[model samples]
Target: MASVTLSGLRKEYGDLTAVDGLDLDVDDGELLCLLGPSGCGKSTTLRMLGGLETPTDGDVHIGDEPVTDQPPYERNTSMVFQSWALFPRKSVIENVAFGLKMDGVSEDERRERAREMLDVVEMGEFVDHDPTDLSGGQKQRVALARSLAIEPDVLLLDEPLSNLDKRLREQMQLELRNIHDAVETTFVHVTHDQNEAFTLADSIAIMHDGDIEQIGAPREVYDDPVSLFIEEFLGDTNLVDATVAEVTETGVIADTAFDTEVDVRTGDAAVAQGDGLSVSFRPEELDVERVEGTDGDGASAVTGEITDVLYRGSTVRFYVDLGGEHLFFEQSVGADTAFSAGDVVRVSWDPDDLLAFAADGARVGRGET
Candidate 1:
């Protein structure tokens, strides 16, 4: 396994830039995911790393070697595509050994290595099966085994499990993580699926408009986003519009869309009075209690009536109408005192749990408190 590095990497198509000047480092044997929406340059970056696309500028390094100019076959990297492009006419074992044969390994050695890789991917029993006869999940395992048979310094995965059913895809995510641990190969996976990245990657690099918005472990990025875009893209949360009413040493007092003033904890953010801001109240961070009436007056709590209750498998989501504005919170289905629609509830949260953003969508304050 080898470390991967990209320095000032860029890619363009005419006037449109697919990848801006980007810099990133992947530790040796680490599985780093390039995650983003479509048109965000994640796939393009992966293509560049695999030598499938030439960068408009900058360098690509695999370990100590500069490989920006190398062809796909010359680079010590193997790519598993989304389509799982297995040879239709070839047997599973033949397909797995094909790369080794191309490298001129003896027939017996290549076959032995192919069988070992098939076993590694739990496909040893299907070695002689036709690729066309295998199920989607089985075909994916064959494709992964074929890539691993090459014993590459780095493996590139381009949304390999996207074609399977949701259940199969989720199952494959765990198996893929286990396979990565076993092989210990440096991996760069590109995907737009948030849960997949969170499940498979050691580190996630979130991309936006051709550049990296943030890069960190799954929980770190989800809990402490650097901007409003990151916060909204990471998960579901209530964003209430407000204007800063007063700046205090601890944080700020802001008039919210719920027709109430709440103290928001902003740690050393350059905020002032009258500035328009959007405060994110994550559903999981809220505390809700069934109340009798809307006459309660608390700075940290708002009285609202439940407008809708959605039963989502093991959890329930409750949407509340705070005057004209709406906010939602979730609870486990097994929790005591389940609420229903039209129930009066009081929603409260700690001031420090709030995350405020400015008009330009930049996060207000240093997130470290």
Candidate 2:
């Protein structure tokens, strides 16, 4: 197993910069994901690391070896793509053996090694079947086996699960995680899908506008996002425009645009009174009930009318209109009574769960609210 390092990595096309000054370290045997929306440079970064695309500036290293000038094969890195990239005219075994054969392995050794890799991906039974005859999942497994057959120091995946149906993709996600655990090979994956990145990677490196935004473990990134873009992109969250009214011992009190003052848990830093802030919280953290009195069971409460009710699986989502501003709150089945559209209710949440950021939207939490 080997680690990967990128120093001052950049890619440009005339005036268009696809990747800009990226500095990242993918730990040995750790699966790292480059995640972002379209044109955010995750794929471009992956291509540079795989040696498929040349970086305009920077150095790439695999373990202790500097591979900045090496070709794809010469860098000991194998890439799996969303297209599967399997051979239509070849059998599953043949497709898996192609890389080994190209590497000048003996005919007998290539076949044996390919079969072993196929078994690792649970496609051993499909070895003799034509790749054209297999389903999307089977084809992807063959593609993965093909990459592993070469025993490369690093494996790169570019949106490899994006083409599959929802159910199949979820199933493959678990299978892929299990496979990575078994291989102990360093992997760098690029994808725009948040769920895919969260489930597959040991840590996620978020990219935006050709730059690295935030890189951390899944929970750390999701729970304490470094910016407004991160909070909105990684999950469903609410951001209320507000101004700090007072800085308390535990957190800070913010006065929202709705004319309500809320106590927000200081995340990474503290802000003083009069500072502009954006208060954030997940919909599931909200507590909603009929407004019978001023008391909200100690949580900050807001009066609103339900404008919509959405039923999704065991959870029901309620969209509320609070004086022309819309906010969403959700509850699981049997955890609380469901609300109907047009119902007058009060939405409240724990102050400690509320997070506030600077007006610029950068993360400022560390209990600083």
Question: In model 1, where is the ten-residue run with the lowest total lDDT?
Answer: 291-300
TM-score against native, each model: 0.98, 0.94
Clash count, one per candidate: 0, 11
Native-vs-model 1 lDDT?
0.93
Instruction: State each model's CA lDDT, in order.
Output: 0.93, 0.86
- Return the top candidate by TM-score: 1
* TM-score, cand. 1 vs. native: 0.98
What number of backbone clashes does candidate 1 have, counting pairs of residues 3 or more apart or in separate chains? Answer: 0
Residue 175, candidate 2: alpha-carbon lDDT: 91
Q: Which lDDT value does model 2 have at 14?
A: 96
In model 1, which regions exceed 4 Å deviation?
none
| lDDT tens readout by residue for model 1, 1-369 | 999999999999999999999999999999999999889999899999999999999999999999999999999899999999999989999999999999999999999999999999889999899999999999999999999999999999999988999999999999999999999999999998999999999999999999999999998888788889888888889999999999988888999988899988886688889999999999999999988887664778899999999999989999999989999999999899899898999999988889999999888885644
